[model samples]
Target: MENQVTQLLKAMVKPDYTACSYAFMQDGKIVCADAIGVIDKINNQPITTDCTFNVCSISKIYCTVCVMQLVDEGLIQLEDKVA
Candidate 1:
């Protein structure tokens, strides 16, 4: 299963699609966080695990964490919204 996912990622790369990152989650734990491709064209090289990538949509994870904390404290109803 993991190998197939990796192969699929490698197959998806393109000149324009220079970088990619993925995280595997299990039981709410991040088991794998990896990336591939180049950071800068001037120093063209594949991205490494240590490289920082902009986690754009992933900013919602913090929101989720905050919501979970609210739930834990019994401070929010399931349908509550911040306004």
Candidate 2:
């Protein structure tokens, strides 16, 4: 499975791409973690699974889901101010 995933990533990597990282988890435990390509294209620094990424809009979706969960639990009101 990991070999297949790596092959897929290698195929997807383009000349313009710097790096890619992936993790697969089951039951809250990581089953596979891999990183490919360079962290700094200029310096040629390699990336690792431990590298941090700015996940942008995905964070907003996570926050919205968390707020919705709180509303479902009657811990927060939808009309309430976030601050």
Question: Which is the leading candidate under TM-score?
Answer: 2
Per-model TM-score versus the true fold? 0.58, 0.72
Best by lDDT: 2
Per-residue lDDT over 1-83 for candidate 2, one digit per residue giving the tens place of the 0 to 100 score: 88899999989988699889899999999999898888898888999999989989999999999999999999999999966
Candidate 1 positional error at 59, Å? 1.4
User: Cα deviation of 4 in candidate 2 (Å)?
Assistant: 0.9
Off by over 4 Å in 2: 64-83
Q: Which stretches of candidate 1 lie over 4 Å from their true place?
A: 25-33, 61-75, 78-83
Q: Rate the local accuracy (lDDT) of all candidates.
A: 0.78, 0.92
* RMSD each, Å: 4.0, 2.4
lDDT of 1 by residue, 1-83 (tens): 55666677888978788787677899999787767678776689878767786778788998889888989999987887769
